[model samples]
Target chain A: MNQEIRDGLRAAVPVIISAAPFGVLFGALAVDNGLSVFEAVTMSATVFAGASQMVGIELFGQSIAPWLIVFSVFAVNFRHVLYSAAIGRRMVSFTPLQKGLSFFLLTDPQFAIAEARYEAGHRLTFRWYATSGLALYVFWIAETWLGALFGRLLPDSHALGLDFLLTIYFLGLVMSFRKRALWLPVVLASSVASIIAFNVVGSPWHVSLGALAGILVAAAAPLEGVREDEANEGRADA
Target chain B: MSDGTTLLVILGAALATFATRAGGHLVLSRFRSIHPRVEAGLNAVPAAVLTTIVAPAAFNGGVAELGALAVAALASLRFGMTTLFAAGAVTLIGLRALGL
Candidate 1:
């Protein structure tokens, strides 16, 4: 391939590696969730958001209202809006089509990779962004396909705790918060709100409710000298 | 849901996701500055969402579930993300088998 694709692929290594199992797990679970192979793979291919897709698939299994599923997906993905602004301004020369593709492929790993590279002072290239994004984009779809085909081979994924892997991953994510004082309160507040939302209010709304609580608390908290760049770092999912 | 609705659901989600990704880039491509508070709020989303997923399960889940969560957390911190999964499922199952 060309230099851009290679560079992009190289940069995507950690993301691809980390995401592979999760992708596979998602695929297997999609099957378990009663999605046909076509539907499962298609969702991964098109929707291209892992966590939200998980939410969508779960709601789909429960046969929740489609709009609620869509809403939950939106709620999970709303973070991308903030992600786009952080990375988009850097792609000043990108055409409208590129803009469309950039967001189509906008995801946590690609965003995280690009954010890390740019923050380190490497000049951000549309090529690098596009290539790396595409690398992840394709791998996610392919692996999901593999997962679905082989999903039945695995024992009950939930019984095996496959579902909790992402949650575990996220818990590890909390350790990344170097601002010790801040993260504790944010987590505590989020936990309380999430539990309340999970129990009293409704289903899956807990995820969004908890997250919003964290955001609101974080916004009002004293994060002196906190810059726009710092915000980009923590925006990726586990 | 019918086949059409299922398709619509997927399509709707894809569209909504694409909008979020593209919308911000389209709007912000014209600018150089972002408000620090807005930035901070965005930054907090990931962690907050993560806590939403982890806290509930770890706190409210059964003995096997709780044991699995503890294993996942300790393993992840010690071995790192490269270890690839929560490893809690097996642990949780094992704990249950042991009558924990």
Candidate 2:
């Protein structure tokens, strides 16, 4: 294998290792939240968005409307659109099949790696993305299965506050972009909007409203300078 | 949740999640040259979206938790700790103390 492929695989291994415990946690939580083994495993296999899956289970436990649950999950994960767009723009040179396959494998960490590669002017192909994705896929399914089997046996995880893992993960992600003052306002506004929506509209709609508010506000704000700065940085790195 | 209905709901949720995850790629596949406006929108979307999601978690906590996250963010900026490590460390400490 070429060095690029080797590097891609090397990068992907850490992600897979990290995902293993997360996957197991999801699997265990799904069962604890009252999903059957098949149901939990199927959801993990088919859906593959960890946060949305957890939220869906929580909503279901609370007897929320199914359509609302679906909508909420969609809203929470809408950022994938931007990720897909970024990858799609670059994969324009590839074939339709190549593009489709790559799209299927675009998860958060994978997208992060891919973007870093792109900004570095590295030659990232569909195959590279696919390799990383396939690795994650295996770990995800395995972890879910393990969790479903062993999750019920475990003690109260809520007391352990394992649920806060997602929160911490998001905080880390947001902090990474804290270089600019503009992001601080964006974060504050969105948080306030989401909290208000959560109280007013309640469960599912709260997520949608909060996400919409954030998207609209961020888009309308002046970000031309930030964009130019990022592009310049990317060019300099190249 | 009825078992049958729950199964259906789970399936629906999974499908919905997949759709959103896949939606952007499907939309972008047809385009050759993306409009500059669309590009701008896409670039800003993550910051907006992530900010919305993270805000509740960071501040929803009590004063101590909020303080910890603030400290973590400051540490990230000043000390140059990786965002993930710093945030994780702060949350671990804060939540442990809060007994949440």
Candidate 3:
């Protein structure tokens, strides 16, 4: 394998390792929320968005409207639209089949790594991207199954603080971007908006509104010339 | 909901979510020459949206606990602790010990 591919896979392994426990926590929560083991694993396999799956399971437990549950999942995952755009540009020269396969594996961490690689003038072949995706895919399925089976043996996750994993994941992402001061206000504003929306509107809608508000605010804010230059360089690589 | 019905619904929702993600790529692939500005904006969207979702949950779980977590987050950042799990673990343990 070329050095670029080797480096990409190496960079991705640590991320996949970190993601394993989060997957297990999701599996435990899925069953605890009253999903059957089969249903839980199926969701992990097919849906693949951890936070959305958790939200869907919670809404299911509450016996919410099916359409509302679907909408909520979409809202939570709407960021994938952005992921698609970014990844799509990188794979723009690939055949439709290759593009389609890569798109299926897109997720937050994968996108972050892929975008960074592309920006650094690294060549991301289909095989490299697929390898990262496949690793994560296997880890997610296996961890979910384990969590569902062992959930009964484990203590209450919320009490044990496993519930905090999702927050930790987000904070890590934010900390990684600490050099970009613009993100600070954008994140803070979106969070405050969501909390207010939660009080006024409620569960699913709050998430959607808060996210939309954040994206709009961030997109509107002017980036420093250096940030813009970096973004342009990343874009040029695609 | 009955077991059979719930199973059907969960499966259906899972398929729908997958389609939404897959479908975006399927459709967008046909287009050529997407605007550079749009592409740049989209690149930043995932991190921004994720931050919005995570920040409130970290700080707003409960007021006192939120304060404890803030302290932990600051400490973690100050010490250049790169692992999020470490920061979160410390905050949770500290809060419990403080009787919050």
Model 2: runs farther than 4 Å from truth? A1-22, A55-79, A116-124, A155-161, A178-185, A203-208, A221-238, B1-14, B28-32, B78-87, B94-100
Q: What is the Cα-based lDDT of residue B94 in candidate 3?
A: 62
Candidate 3 DockQ, CA atoms = 0.38
* Comparison by DockQ, 1 against 3, better one: 1
Under CAPRI classification, how is model 2 graded?
acceptable
Model 1 ranges with Cα > 4 A deviation: A1-36, A51-76, A85-99, A108-132, A147-151, A179-181, A226-238, B1-9, B25-32, B63-80, B83-100
Ranking by lDDT: 1, 3, 2
| Chain B TM, every candidate | 0.67, 0.69, 0.68
Better of 2 and 3 by lDDT: 3
Mark the 10 consecutive residues where model 2 chain B has the least summed lDDT: B78-87
- For candidate 1, the docking band is acceptable
Q: After superposition, how far is residue A26 of candidate 1 from its true place, in Å?
A: 5.7
Alpha-carbon DockQ of candidate 1 = 0.45
Ranking by DockQ: 1, 2, 3
TM-scores of the candidates are 0.70, 0.73, 0.75
Which is the leading candidate under lDDT?
1
lDDT tens digits by residue: candidate 2, A14-133: 466545667888888888888888988888777787767888787877878778888877776766776776566667467877776666567777776675566546777766777777
Q: Clashing residue pairs in candidate 1, if any?
A: none
Candidate 1 vs 2: which has more TM-score: 2
Candidate 1 local lDDT, A1-238, one digit each (tens) = 8776687777776567657777887898888888888998999998999989988888888968889888889887887776676677566667878877887888976765665556546677779889899888899999899999996676565555555555555565554442433667778889999988888886567876887898888788865756445655534311
Off by over 4 Å in 3: A1-22, A32-35, A59-72, A116-123, A156-160, A179-185, A204-207, A221-238, B1-8, B23-37, B62-88, B94-100
Q: Going through the candidates in order, what is the number of backbone clashes in each?
A: 0, 0, 0
